[model samples]
Target: MEGATPPASATATTPDAPSARSAPAGRPAVVVLSSLVARGSVGGRAVVFALERMGFPVWFLPTVLLPWHPGHGRASRHVPPADAFAALAADLARAPWLGEVGAVLTGYFGSAEQVEAAAGLVAAIKAARPDALYLCDPVIGDQKPDGSGGLYLPEATAIAIRDRLMPLADIATPNRFEAGWLSGLPVGSTAEAIAAARALGPGTVLVTSAPAMMHRSVATLLVEATRCLQAEHPLVEGAPNGTGDLLAATFLARRLDGMTSEAALPRALGAVFEMVARSVRAGSDELVLAAEQDTILHPMAQVTVRAIATPKPRAK
Candidate 1:
């Protein structure tokens, strides 16, 4: 809690007199808990950048730290001890500014214990501000090169996320593999994906890398109680990691800015698609977020959106 408190003078905001240096007024802060890569735009790095670029203040807590994404090469990983992580979570839970947090996004966890602490933090934030939204990105694994999928993290860690964090989430942004694994349903087809999404238990679920109706295209399906919407764009080969993290942050920021899920899906997908395309075109190993930041603010990428028919209940 050493740097938790701000000076009294810093607390005052001049709403009547705006200045170039003044912070954006009335924007609720978002708390992001995930992995941090020192030299990559993955995990908390991607999430924080997207939210901050959208003018939302962020309180980022890294679950693990690495020099870069593990996909690139071997790297040292650091996870805080359980006791210390829990203590830090406790501090944030009891913080005076907890009420200012409008949303919480949880991604990769270094350990099952960290997931437990994050669950507690999410509960506290909800209690402090009932309207706060929680988006859980189940970063367990993705489809492997062989077209098969499994958990990259320990099974215990994956289980902890499925059982502990997912239950508290208002929204879940899981890839096709994760959605299938978490819901214990096959997601090989659009219908199957929709069924799995409904089974996941969140009020809203976004299934990324969904089965696209059009060949050579990628789709993200936004599923809710009564409706399902799909936003699709042509696939970009060899795109870097962190699209999921970026998508979760972008969609959440749009929602907090008063956009409906229907409105947010296309915009968020467009931004992520544009970011990836731009980065790939530049032949960069990582997403060129700093160089092409304008895409995050006003993405001009074309995305096709359509409403999918919700599956009817099976008669007994």
Candidate 2:
């Protein structure tokens, strides 16, 4: 992995995931798969931040190291060549963290080779520790509209995820657009989102950005075989940059702590709403670091989290 300087402005000592609210919690180590843009986003940052707060040892295996973050145009960019996989494999061949490692959480990847490499890492982890949980947050695209179709995940990379990475994942977190692309389902409503999640080959699926068009709200849809759940929050009108990453992180953290999606879904949704509310209050991005940390301590401290019972399936 890479740890380069991205074009965006930098943050603190942690270099990549530095935030005051991001205190370390005594939890297991969760590895993040992404291109570490130095001092980048709360998506990447928040995951590492939140995990660290919970005391889970977090390590980032960036496919590339960016100067800043991908969210901002000014963030500098650096791509680790496709050949770096072998070196990564070798590095993992004898890292002490490998023995203590318990879970793997992958975010965005730049190249197909990186995707393959990430898969290799997952395989190695599982091989070494059979109980290790692999969580794949198919971080392709966020709320970008202009033809950045299907998560902005490269076609080849998407294929690799579907064919290789996904099945190995114990949990998969995908937003609306991503679920459509990954599961071949429609992205219109909550039901569609649930259907898409059910198709991803994993029992635990977290689908975000699922507010129905008729209502100006944000929705997180969770589907687990017979029991489906949905949580909705008032839509924040501006800047929703890093909620996906945060949600992915929150869900992973909760699950790692032995909370099921059914139970963790409410907490994750509350956290997302709290982050957005904090950002709006602070005049910042959708996922604000300071507020995010507070949300972790008190998810419901800001916004109320309500879980609605999912209705039974209707006749096809």
Candidate 3:
């Protein structure tokens, strides 16, 4: 809420701009809306690079801009004025290349109004191409050292995402804390996570950092209408931020490439895990996506996947 207005240089480009270029034969372009950090691989920086590296052209719009992730230190922040943001969204909605977008992936928002604008753009893309997918990563909060978690974003912005944008998503990737907050259910275990995913309203829900069956490990749960799959791997301590952004982009890219959710889950999880491990091993605070590009294309990290029983509904 307290940020400088984006500079004029950040204004929307015309339809003929390079960002509006079409995708290759099989890979349709993806539109990514998130934050941009000048020096980190978080938000749009991570999402755009990963999608493009996977052969999908990306149209990236920043919801906010910062020198680096706030976790680093105090820095200048820039958020586009609500009207200007809406105008840019309107421009994209009417662009002739709108039909080329196969998916729209949304994450952080600087304001509630930005959510409305982004929701409108997603609706426009869906209208232009009915098959287009929308994946929403509710980038609100994470678990704290005390084992409690809450939103890092403004309550109004989070409410906007939950009420307006989420219902429009075909798939949602939320961390355990976000899953619980969105569904108003406890997500302290795998069973509770499955229930919360089912209640989250998306056809597909991937809960990252889910409780694992094995000690000192973590799981990513993929919940659908009838079946749920769990992908577990060793947790990498001190893994930097942006893993979720990478996961969401990778999963969406895989889905667009015709990979089934069952198949994409493990691949995406493996890529994220490997990226984190490599970054931590390098003793870097940010993901080494560029140096570790091989991990994204061909992840060798092993992850175990299995079907999980969906919890039965409670009756009065």
- Tens-digit lDDT track for model 1 on 1-316? 1112222222334442112132234888898999999998999999999999999999998999999999899989999999898888877776667667899999999999898888878877776677889999999988964886688899999998998888788999999999999999999899999999999889999999998989899999999988999889999998999999999999999999999999999899999999999999999999999999999989999899999987666677
How much lDDT does candidate 2 score?
0.68
Task: List candidate 3 stretches off by more than 4 Å.
Answer: 1-24, 311-316
lDDT of 2 by residue, 209-236 (tens): 7654336766677767677666777777
CA lDDT scores, all candidates in order: 0.88, 0.68, 0.88
Please state the error at residue 55 of candidate 2 in Å.
1.2
Every candidate's CA RMSD = 6.5, 8.9, 5.6
TM-score of 2: 0.81
Error of 3 at 268 (Å): 0.7
TM-scores of the models, in the order given: 0.91, 0.81, 0.91
lDDT (tens digit, per residue) of candidate 3 on 28-93: 989999999999899999999999899999999899999999989988999999999988987787
Error of 2 at 68 (Å): 3.6
Total clashes in model 1, counting residue pairs 3 or more apart in sequence or in different chains: 0
The positional error of residue 56 in candidate 3, measured at the CA in angstroms, is: 0.3
Better of 2 and 3 by lDDT: 3
